[model samples]
Target: MIDLGALAKITKAFKVIDNDKSTNRLSHAYLIVCQDAENLEGYMRYFAKQLLCSESVPCESCRHCSLINSNAHQDVFFYPTSEKGILTEDINAIISESYVRPIESEKKVFVLSNAQTMNAVTQNKLLKTLEEPPKNVYILIGTTSEQAILPTVKSRVKKVEISPFSKTVLINALIDQCKDREKLENAVACSDGTLGKTLALYQDQNLKNVIDLGIEILTKMQSSKDVLEYSTKIIKNKTDLDQFFDVLDMLLRDTLVKECGDQSLITNPNALNQLQNANFKNGALISIISAVTDARKRKQFNANQNMLIEWLLFKILEEKFRWQKL
Candidate 1:
C-alpha cells in the first residue's frame, strides 16, 4: 500500500515505487531527499515497508510490516549508525553486513540517513556496493540536500525528492500530536512545513526565550547598546542555530504581516500591537524578510553557522533602522 503518511507531498515518488511494484521492477537504489533528517528517516521506514510487504500491497497486520515499521527488521541496516555521523569504521561494517542475505523478508535494505556524512572513503566503499548489489539487495540513501553528496555517489541512485507540506497539511498532521491549541498554533505559525521541525520547535522549552529575544531586538531598536548586548547574549552560547533563525524569521514574518494590516494572517497574534508599532515600514520589513530567506538558503550550503546568524541579526537591525528614514 502507498505510505500516505510520509509521501503526501511527494506523491510522485510513491507512484514510482507503486508502479515498480506492480511490474516487479523496483530500482535497486533510491535516494530520498528532504530537509529534515528525522522526517527523512521516517520516509526510509515507509519505503522499507513498501519494499518488504508480502501482499500485493503492504498489509499493516503482517509480521514483516510490523518489523519494518518499528525498524526492527533483521535485514535492514541504518547507516551512520550513530549520532557521530558516518566514519570509515562504520563503512567497513556496512560493507561487511551487505553480504548477508535477508533472513526474514524477500529483500534486504540498507538505509543511510544524513547520507552526506559519508566522507570520500566511506562513499567509495558504498560505491562498490551500488555498482554491483547482490540479489534482493536495496540501498536507500536519505539526505537533506543532494548537493552535499558527491555527484558520483548521487549518479547511481534514482532520486526521490520530498518537499515540506503546506501550512494546512502541517497543522492537520500536528493536531493529533499536540493537545494545547495555542501552542499548536504557535508551532504551526513558526514551522517551515516540516513535521520534524514543527514538533521540535513546539516542544522546545527555550522557544519562548528565542522569540522574546527577537522581539526584544525590535523593541530596543532606539538604543544601539541594548541591541548589541542582546545580540551578544544570544550568540555567545551554543545553540540550535537553525531553530534560532527560524524563531527570528517567524517574528519578522509576523511583523511583516502586521505591516500589511492583515490581522488574520498574523502568526504571533499576541504581539500584533507591538509588531505594528515596530520601527519598520512595509518595504523595510519586506527587505529584511528577503534577507532572512537568503540567509536560510545559505545555511543549507553549510555556511559558518555563528557568522551567518550573527550577520543576519545585524542585517535585520540595519534594515529596521534604515527603513525609518523611508
Candidate 2:
C-alpha cells in the first residue's frame, strides 16, 4: 500500500486528479512539463506509486512501495536511455516494452524524464502507442515546457504544469544542502529557482567555478578582445556545456531586468555597478542574447566549442553601443 499524502503542489494537481479519480479519470498518457525538477519528479513518483500499490488508493507502504522505493518495481518500467535526454533507440525500446504485460502489478508505468529530448522521429513512433495505450498502461512524459515537443504527441496526453519554487524557497533548499553561503547564493541566482540544476551546481565544483567565472567574464567584456578572452577561458575549463549555457542565460535575464529598471532581479548585485558601466541598448542586448543562445545550440552538435564561444563573444564585442554614458 502507498499513502498518497497531499502536499501543496500535489493538492493543486489533485483537483484535476479528484475530478477523474472517482471515474478513474486518469489519462492513458500524461505530459508533465515545467522548469521545476523537484515538483516534476514528485508528480511522476506519485503517479507511479498509485498505479502499483495494491491498495485502491495510494499508500506509501506496501509490496509495491518496496519496489518503487528501491526503484526495482518490475511492472513500473522507467525508460532507459544513455544520457540526460531521450534518443531514437530509447523511444523504440519504450514502444517494445509497452507490448509486454505487467510481471506482477496490474499496470505497467513508463516514466520518461526529459521527454522534450524525444526528437520528431521518436515522437512519431510514440504517437501510435500513446493513442492506443494498452489497458492498465500509463505513459508519463516529463520535460521543460520551453522545448518544442511534437504537438501531435502533446495533444494525446493530459498536460500538467509543475511550477518551480520561488527564489526564496529555492535559495533555502540550496542553503540546506550547501555549507558555503556565497556558493549557495550564487547557485540560487544562477538556477533561477530550479532546484535540480541548483543542486547540480552545488555538487560539481567545476560547474560552480564556471558560474563564478561566467559572471566575471560577462562583467569584463569591455571589447571584442575581452569577450574572446573570456570565452577562451570557458572553453578550457571542460565544465558541463549546459552549465555554461545556464550562466549565460542568467546573465541575459539579469541584463533584461536591469534594462527594465528592476534592479532586484540582478544576480550579480555587486556587478550591477559594472553592468551599469557599459550602457547597452535593447537592440544590443537582444543581439548578445541571440548570439549566446545560438552558440549553446551549436555546442550540442559537437560544433567547435572554442570557435563557437569566441565567435559569440565577438558578436557581443562588435556591438559598440555603450550604455547611455553611465
Best by lDDT: 1
TM-score each candidate. 0.73, 0.63
Residues 1-326, candidate 1: write the lDDT tens digits: 22345444245566677778789888899887888776677777777777787665567678987887776889888777778887778767767777887799778888888887877878888888888888888888888878878788788988886777666666677776688766776677778777787788789777666666667666765554655665567668555666667766777777777667666666667554556556677777788878878888998999886667667767777887787876
Model 2 per-residue lDDT tens digits across residues 166-216: 566666545544888767766766675556666766666775577667666
Q: What are the RMSD figures for all models against the true structure?
A: 5.0, 6.1
- Candidate 2 regions exceeding 4 Å error are 1-15, 22-24, 33-43, 50-156, 163-166, 192-194, 223-232, 235-242, 261-283, 298-304, 320-326
What TM value does model 2 have? Answer: 0.63
Where does candidate 1 clash, by residue pair?
Answer: 1-58
lDDT of each: 0.74, 0.68
